[model samples]
Target: MAVAIRLRQEGSKGRLFYRVVAADQRFKRDGRFIEILGTYDPQKKGENTNIDIEKVNSWISKGAQPSETVRSLIKRQVKAQASN
Candidate 1:
């Protein structure tokens, strides 16, 4: 099964919240997921998201592809972590 790491949109409208998850590509965007890697709160700036880098890397190694937005989020998180 092709796996994809992507965002699962939640929360009420006008206030967007997201969960970073690993799921089968065939599954609907917010339908089902294998695991919850972390969360993203766009309304907040830096330090607004929390992701398990190890888990993400593991999934990637296992052939899970992350969506564009999730990729950017991962990059941003890495950059922020490096500064600490």
Candidate 2:
């Protein structure tokens, strides 16, 4: 099955949160997922994304394609890591 790394929505209407996940591309955006790689909190101040780059790299090496938004999130995480 084709796999994709994407976001799964959670929390209430006004306070939305997301989980970075690896799942079958055929499934619904918030449906079955293979793993929970990390979390993203837009409401948080400063560094708002908390994703495991190691796990993300593993998924990428395994041919799991991340959506454009996820790709940008990964980049942001990487940059943050480097600055620390």
Candidate 3:
């Protein structure tokens, strides 16, 4: 089975919230997921991303590929955390 780490969209039409999840590559965007890693709220100003780096790293090591946007988010979050 092809595993993927990607975003699951939620919330209302105009407003959007996202959950970072580990799921099968064949599943629909918001379909069943293996686990919930964290969340992303684009509407928020600062610190809109809340992710578990440990979990993400584990999934990656297990061969789960992240989406383009999720990849960038992870990089940014890790960099911010390192600076603190």
Per-residue lDDT tens digits of candidate 2, residues 1-84?
Answer: 999999999999999999999999999989999999999988999888999999999999999999999999999999989998
| Residue-wise C-alpha lDDT for candidate 3, range 22-61, written one tens digit per residue | 9999999999999999999999998999999999999999
- After the best TM-score superposition of candidate 3, give how far the Cα of residue 59 lies from its true spot, in angstroms: 0.6
TM-score, cand. 2 vs. native: 0.97
Clash pairs detected, candidate 1: none
Better of 1 and 2 by TM-score: 2
Runs in model 3 lying further than 4 Å from the true structure: none
State in Å the error of residue 71, model 1.
0.7
Better of 1 and 3 by lDDT: 3
TM-score of each: 0.94, 0.97, 0.96
Report the lDDT tens digits of candidate 1 across residue range 1-84: 999999999999899899999999999989999999999998997589899999999999999999999999999889989999
